[model samples]
Structures are given as C-alpha cells and as structure tokens.
Target chain A: GAGVSQSPSNKVTEKGKDVELRCDPISGHTALYWYRQSLGQGLEFLIYFQGNSAPDKSGLPSDRFSAERTGGSVSTLTIQRTQQEDSAVYLCASSLAQLAGGNEQYFGPGTRLTVT
Target chain B: AQSVTQLDSQVPVFEEAPVELRCNYSSSVSVYLFWYVQYPNQGLQLLLKYLSGSTLVESINGFEAEFNKSQTSFHLRKPSVHISDTAEYFCAVTRNAGGTSYGKLTFGQGTILTVHP
Candidate 1:
C-alpha cells in the first residue's frame, strides 16, 4: 500500500457491544503502533509492535482494551464491552524502521468508534 | 516520564497573517521532536522534524519550527497563513531509551489552527 489503511472508517455500537478496528500498514514497514484520540483531544499512545519482539502494551487504558499484530503486517484493536467513554477516533501508524532516531510514522485514516 | 504540551488549544488568524503554535516538553533525557498536521476528518501528516542539525527546520509548505533545548520548546511558526491551513497541529516527542524505547512516540494535546478569510 502507498500509505496506511484502516477498516470500518466509522463504527457505531451499543454500550455493551464489542468493536474491532483493523489497520493495514505500508508493506515492509517493521514497526506498528496504535493510538486513540478523544474528541478534541490529543493522540493517546496505546501500544507498539516492532518486528516479532514482545509488544509494548504499557499504554492500554484498561483491561478491556487489547490489540494484536499478526505477521508484522496487519493489526487489530479490540475493545470489549465498550462504554460511552470509548467513543473516539482510533488511529494506527507504522514506521519503515524501528530505530527511535530515524523513524517517522505514517498514519492511517483512522476508525471513528461511537458507543451509544 | 516524558510529556509534551501545546499551551494554546486553539489559534485563530486571518489569512496571510503570521501564526505560531507553541509546544513544550518535559524530559530528563534527550528526545526527537516532530510536528504533524491534520486536516478535517483526515489522518495526521508529518510536517517536519528535529533530530540533529541546525536549531531551525523548515517544512515544504512554508511552515518552520525551531528547537530550543534549554527551554524544552519546539514551537511551530508560519509567516503567512492560508485558509487551507486551517486544521489541527500536533507536537510529538520520541525518546531514545535504548532497549525500552524503540518506535513509541508521545504527543501533545494539539492546537487547532483556524485561518479565517
């Protein structure tokens, strides 16, 4: 892909329902990241995946928020028992390399999830 | 702990007027600084970055920012604003903590730039 791509550009669900967001990063990129943006707020770091090493899940807000990246290409973010507070835009980004000094992440369109 | 702050949540300027969006970070370690812009309903796009070079960096679209180490600030500035530039701007930082920090980046609260005609 020329740039990162996300699925279900917008998702509206009931309070107790579960919602899944997907991200397809640029091919051959070695690093993937997940972030959430509340309405009129800044980007909140969620998780990060680099190659096949252990993912950094320190940013997951709660136990209900979880994500996984498969084969180091595609990633999914799942929210179990979504709450009204979960309504926000979920973004995914990937970088060509994992090094901190030379990595500029490319972001996807983002999935706007609204829990009614 | 590293945190970035955009002091002004919203900035409004007339088209062709000068504008500046302030960003400051608190960190005990050296970090990389970045600026990203987001149009309405669009994803964030990188504007420019400060890794290692001259204290000032310029973007292709007439936007520039200067990295101030002592003040811990990376403020973005534009001499002339365009209506098309009305969007949200974010400041981010990436710290190099060796093994613990690989590709993770922290961002500020973002400033909404509204360029009125």
Candidate 2:
C-alpha cells in the first residue's frame, strides 16, 4: 500500500459495548505500533508488534485492551466493555526495521473512537 | 523508560513571526529524537528527526530542530511562521539499546501552535 491505513475512521459507541479498531501497515514493514491520543494529552504508546508477534505490550492501559497482528500485516485492537474514558484517537504506525537505534515510523490516518 | 517533555501547552503568535517550541527528554541510555506535527483532524507526520550526526536537522517546510545531548533537549524552531503552520507539535524519543526491539516511541504532551494573521 501507499502508506499505513486504518479502518473505521470514525466510530461512536455506547458505554459497555465492545469495539474493534483495525490497522494495515505499509507492505513489508516489520514493526507496528499502537497509540492512543486523548483530548489534551500526548500520544500514549499502547503496544508494539514485531511481525505476527508482539514483544512489547508494556503500554497497554489495562486488561480490557488487547491487540493482535496476523500474517505480519493487518492488526486489530479490541476494547472490551468500552468506557467513556476510552474516547480518543487510535493511531497505528509501522517502521521498516529496528536497527542501529531506531527507524522512522510511518503513521496511519487514525481512527477517532467516541464512547458515550 | 524514556520520556519527553514539551514546555508549553499552547503558543499563539502573529504571522511572519519567529517561533520556537521547547522539548526536553530523559533517558538512562542513548536514544534517538524526533519531532512530529499533527494538523487538524489528521494523523501525525514526522517533521524531523535526530538519529545521529550533526546536532541540527531540518524539514522541507522550513522548520528545524537541534538535538542537544548534554541538555537532553530537541527543540523545534522556525524563523518565520505562516497561517498554515498552525498545528500540534510533539517531541518523541526511542531507545537505542541492543535487544529484541519493536521501536516503541515515548512522546511528550504536544504543544499547540496557533498562528494569527
């Protein structure tokens, strides 16, 4: 693909319902990341996937938040029993490879999740 | 863990004026620095980064940032501001350690730049 792409650009869900956000990283990119941008806050790292496996899930806020990547391509972020505080912009990014320190990540057009 | 700090939350300036957004980082080990910009209702775009080399880095859009290792700062600056420059700017850092790495980035609370005409 041209760049990282995310599905459901905008999603409004009621409290207590579950929601899923998806991301398709750039082709052949080996590293993928998830972040949450709350109103008036910085980008909060959620999880990082190295191909089909996730090695750094340290940033996941809680047990309700979980993510998985399949076939080293698409990723899904699931929020069980969504809460009002979950309203934020969900962002996805991918990098070519982690070497010699770091690689610049290309970002997706983020999904704006609104829980009421 | 590494952390970034953006001093000001919001900065309002008149068009054609110079601007500087301050950022500081903390890390126990060597790390790469970066500045990202987010436009209205858009995803963040990498403006510039300081992986290694000269302390100075630039963007095509006339914005520049300097990585000061001694001070642990990577401040973004521009000589002149335009209305189109209004956006949210973020400073980020990632570890340069050796290990099974996924390149997780730690970001600062963004600074919102408002350019007045």
Candidate 3:
C-alpha cells in the first residue's frame, strides 16, 4: 500500500461490549504500533509488533486490551468489555525498520472508537 | 522511561504571523526527537526530526525545529503561518539504546494551531 491504512473509520459500541480495530501498514514495513488518543489527551502507546511477534506489550493498559499481527502484515486491536473511557481514536503506525533508534513511523488514518 | 511535555494546548494566530510551539522531554539516555502534524480528520504526518548532526532540522513545509540537548527541548517554529497550517502538532521521543526495542514513540499532548484569516 502507499500508506498505512485502517478499517471502519468510525465505530460506536456500547459499554461492556467488545470492539476490534484493524490496521494495514505500508507494504513490507517491519514495525507496527498501536496508540490510543482520548479527547484533550495525548497519544498513549498501547502495543507494538515487530514482524509476527510482539516484544513490547508494556504499554497495554490492562488485560482487556490485546493485539496480534499475522504474516507480519496486518494487525488487529481487540478491546474486550469496552468501557466508556475507551472511547477514543485508535491509531496505527508503521516504520521501515524495527530498531528503536533512527526510524520514522508512518501513521494510518486511525479508527475512531466511540463507546456509549 | 521517557516523557514529552507540550506546554501549550492551543495556539491561535493570524495568517502570515510567526508561530512557535514548545516541546520538552526527559530521559536518562540519548534519544531521537520528532515532530508530527495532524490535519483535520487525518492521520499524523512527519514534520521534522532531529536524529543526529546539527541541532536544527527543517521540513519542506517551512517549519523547523531545534533540538536543544541541554534544555531537552525540540521546539517547532515557523517564520510565517498560513491558514493551511491550522492543525494539531505533536512532539515525540524514542530512546536510542540499541536493543530489540523498536521505536515506540512517547508523544506529548498535542497543541492545536488555529490560524485566523
């Protein structure tokens, strides 16, 4: 793909339900990241995937949040028992390299998740 | 761990006026700095970055940022602003320590720039 892409641009879910956000990174990009942005708040790191594995899952707020990548390509962020506080924009980013240093991330359009 | 601080939450200015958005960071080790801009209903785009070399870095959109190591700041500046410049700006940092860590950026609360006609 020319740029990172995300699906279901907008999603409205009820509290206690589950929601899944998806991201398709740039073709051949090796690194992928997920972030949550609340109203009037900064981007909060959630999880990151390198290839088909995730080495950095420390940012996930709780066990209700989980993510996985397959074939080192697309990724899905699943929030189980979604809470009202989970209403935020879910963003996905990709980078050419997997190293922590000396890399620039390309971001996707982001999925706006609204929990009612 | 690293953190980013964007002092201002919003900055309003007239078109053709100069603008500056301040950003600061705290980290024990060396880090890479970056600035990104997000237009309305869009994803963030890289504005500029300070990876190495001269402390000052520039973007083609007439925006520049200076990486001040001593102050741990990477303030973005534009000599003149335009209506098109109205957007949200974010500052981010990632530790430079070599390891399995992929660049997980720690971002600041964005500053929304509103340019008046």
User: Could you tell which candidate, 1 or 3, scores higher by DockQ?
Assistant: 3
Model 1 collision count: 0
Per-prediction DockQ: 0.65, 0.69, 0.79
Show where candidate 1 strays beyond 4 Å: none
Comparing candidate 1 with candidate 2, which one achieves the higher DockQ? 2
Docking quality tier of model 3: medium
Per-residue CA lDDT of model 3 for B7-108, tens digit only, reads 999999999999999999999889999999999978899999998899989999899999998999999999999999999999999988887557899999
**Tens-digit lDDT string for candidate 3 (A1-116):** 38999999999999999988999999989889999888866698998888989988998989999999999999999999999888889999999875556688999999999989
Colliding pairs, model 1: none
DockQ order of candidates, best first? 3, 2, 1
RMSD, model 3, all Cα superposed?
A: 1.1
- Supply candidate 1's per-residue lDDT for B60: 96
Per-candidate local distance difference test: 0.90, 0.92, 0.92
